[model samples]
Target: MSTLTTANPAYKLELTSSPHIHSRWSTKQAMWMVVYALIPAVIAAIVFFGFYQLIIISMSVCVCVLTESAIKYFRGREISIMDGSGIITGLLLGLILPPNFSLFGTALGSVVAIALGKEIFGGLGFNIFNPALVGRAFLQATYPVPMTTWSEPSYAVDSVSSATPLSAMKFDAVFAGKTEMLLGNIGGSLGETSSLAILIGGIFLIAIQVVNWRIPVAMTLSVIVFGGIFWLIDPAVYPDPIFHILSGGFLMGALFMATDWVTSPLNSKGMWIYGTAISLVIVIIRLFGGLPEGVMYAILFMNGFVPLINKYSVPRIFGEAK
Candidate 1:
């Protein structure tokens, strides 16, 4: 009998369907890819919000990793932060936050995200709500004033931060101009300031095939459809669809947060429904609700219903009756 050695001529390499799925594009890869996609936004934050943004992001990530590690350690379970889910959650929570937010608040948000959003429902892929959005919502509810407070950067004389365009529009409709909203020159959350930067990151994600384009597309369309209706009713009061799409957290939330594979729906039809529903909730809240911005809450809220959407929207197999 011939031995199966490298030198033996009988050696055969068995090829399988999933053979190439070794370690190149795994869960770890996905986590790292998300981080990679956010680098541009991080750079944008640093430019627009200053270096303290980096500090906030770092501290938030550190807290999340430590919080999760400690939970596993005290419970006599294995270290789980290595999976990088904590890292992704940290970045997402950090990026959505305002630049000057206190370190303690960021840490609290991280804890809420990892503990309530992730660990309670089982870590990583098993979670129902998007962890980062959970943190965002918690912070928004607990610290309504500070969370909404925004400061514009000064290229001119010394100036203080001001409310963002969307926030302003939420209160009064007269401030929605063409240039201010388009260029993202207003003050807002660290990541939501720059629609240009967010769109760049979105393009990279779509290029890598890491995110499903369907969700963003559907979400954008839904926003336009809903916003357009209001604009038609009162063009003077309601901002145009372009301003609606660019201002606030719509692009940032739809492209980066809402498209999270683990939390969002799985099927193509489900993605459209998920995106559309979220967009509707966001528009409704921003238009009539108390909160100036509602993208984060809308996403987390709809994330709760994703399983049901996936359960029903799944296309039946061919020749198989439902």
Candidate 2:
């Protein structure tokens, strides 16, 4: 029999998956890191929307925490609210909502996010779609009027209530200037208001390796290329590529939502494919479809194919003879 260890043994062969050297990281660590990275976007939302926006965020978070805690208590599992996943879901959901959304509605969305999007699907790692987005989609379906009724950004309060850039482009051929969209001075969802802030958060996440950079880069480039083609062909109707990239939830969706580890693909190749497909779907819906924006739908639709993407993209065994 061959000996597996030496006399001075400081190492051992552990049978596991590809990542044999397990780091000291845990789900809690990754979850909290993501929460910390979102601070910049949260601050920007508050600044743009005011103290009232804070209340909406607080309510959503509180309700989400409570909902998850209750589920765990009933399921005989240790309550893991401190894990930060539920908090991230709540914050993301709240950030995507209109700032003036009613408190009760926001709370309801939080409950759905935790219960349906997460717990019903066997909780965090098992969920197939991004939980926050699932909740947002439910809200959109149930409350279309409220979901579409956006409030103006703080800087433009003196101006009349306005449609979002995508909506304007779709309905009136009106183009929102790039500067306001970059600085987040125009009307949209709480988080989508500021491209600058979302970029800051995205950079932090990428720097810390909290998210894979490939998905965002791929998605962004696809949108630019696709949108640019349409714009060059018919500038009279289609807005420029920069507008599509900066407006609405494109940055937030590409960076934070679409990159959810549980929902997105596993391999680099699959990630590029997923990102490119998502961007194409978004442009198709925004340009030709009835809806003005499509990030949420695009992400959720692609999420369904993640399993197939992973299956086909798996690496072949090394040094194997066929």
Candidate 3:
């Protein structure tokens, strides 16, 4: 038998396991990049809401970090708070909450986000649902009245009882102008109100290749196509597709929540399926369901199917026998 060796005695082929391909990208680096991307939304939230909203964001982040540290310490794991995942979870949860949501409530949600949403599932890479959305859902279910309470932009005066665009449309038969929705002058969640801010952050993430472009594109196209169908059928009854894109949590969830590295599918085809299904559910719920918004529910619902999607959607190896 011929022995495999290099011409140079020191040079020899090394045997390694799979994943022969590697990138310089680290989980810490990616997590911090996501933090940077969320800055615009944070700034926008401060502008649209009041300076007090900063307290909510700060408290949430602190709580999340502390909760994660505690859990990791109890489990005898190395502290990983500096990795930035906890901050991202806190920031996302704060952004989705109603303006001026109680600090205690925000803290409670933060603990659940870290303890139940993440650590309970074996931490960061193993989480099945976006931790932030989990926190939001918990808040929504536990405190429906406070969670649904909306506030007008800080600039608005003499506006009584601010209602989200979706809620206004669904309950009062009132439609907010597209300009108001686009500019985020209308009432909604802290970060979700400003489609402009979200687009700025989301596009930056895609540009840096930190976020997969397929998920957001698939979601946007799906919403446009499905939502457009209903609008075309009865323009007078349904708001235009642009309205759906600009209002509620669709943009935020599609770009940030649904695109979570752990919870989302592993392949391009699976991404399309995941994004489309979430959008379809959102349209159905927004148009016909009791709740005015469904982005959180839709994304979480699809997250459960990501494993199956990945299992079946895996690409065939080149030249492999079929």
Candidate 4:
């Protein structure tokens, strides 16, 4: 017979690594800060795509948060829907999607992002891939035709073509001006169209140290080197390096998705390698492969190598001998 004792649980000490200084910041703070940074791009999306875009964005966000919460509930774990990471992931996934993408597909992608991409790996810090990109990859595989379909922005006239700049280059042998691409008067994904908006937001994040600057810089440099080489080889056969850098999802991938804290490599050297490798893959895929745009695939491919890069590029211990 066991006696029932009304005793409270004993307190236990938790042990961890060094550098115990606790900052005022937290995961929620960082996530929300990123959300704030992405606001300009969201605004740009609405301006260019119209109100329906907001509906898609809202649907994605709600579904993502709900899916995360449901998974936690089923597993009997603490709910983390309020943390803002899901919102950011959903927003990013939606931003990269075409404005006219089916809402059901968008919601399904959000669920996959939260369930398989994040929760299956035990949530935020432990995930191997960027959740947004994971959702996008799934969507691209399942709905290739819809994913590739392009629509004109609201500011364009009825005569304007519905093809994205990259698509125009790939199929129609035409190129949009730098001015249209930069200002986002051209057709593309919701958030990726406006270089000006993405730059404003991305620069803000880098300025505040929310995002590492080395990744974007290295990627941009590699694009310049490889793309310039191709352009110089035959200007008539290839678009200019400047055009490659500005068009498609390159800026959005470099600034936001590729720099994801959970997926990107740690330390400056590893980040440089990661960024450069991703850029090279993008250039190769766009220039030599069947795809017109390759940012999504390139980032996902490099994400698999982050662990190896981190292993090799670990920073030297302070005061350690050669």
Tell me the tens digit of each residue's lDDT in model 3 across 21-67: 34344667878888999999999899989898899999999999999
**Model 2: runs farther than 4 Å from truth?**
1-25, 156-161
Q: Which candidate leads in lDDT?
A: 3
Question: lDDT for every model?
Answer: 0.80, 0.86, 0.88, 0.87
Candidate 2, residue 195: the lDDT equals 95
User: Least accurate stretch of 10 residues (summed lDDT) in model 2?
Assistant: 1-10
Query: Poorest 10 consecutive residues of model 1 by lDDT?
Result: 1-10
Model 4 clash pairs?
none
lDDT of 4 by residue, 1-322 (tens): 0111112236244353432434345556767878998898899899988989989888999999999889988988777766788999999999999878999999989999999899999876778999999998999999999988887898666424789998888887798889888988888999999999999999988887778899999999999999999999988878898998899999999999999877998778999999999999998998888989999999999999999998999778999998
TM-score of each: 0.88, 0.91, 0.92, 0.92
Off by over 4 Å in 1: 1-24, 155-161, 177-183
- lDDT rank order: 3, 4, 2, 1
As a whole number from 0 to 100, the lDDT of residue 45 in candidate 1 is 79
| Candidates in order: C-alpha RMSD to true structure | 6.6, 5.6, 6.2, 5.8
Of candidates 4 and 1, the better by TM-score: 4
- Number of backbone collisions per candidate: 2, 0, 0, 0
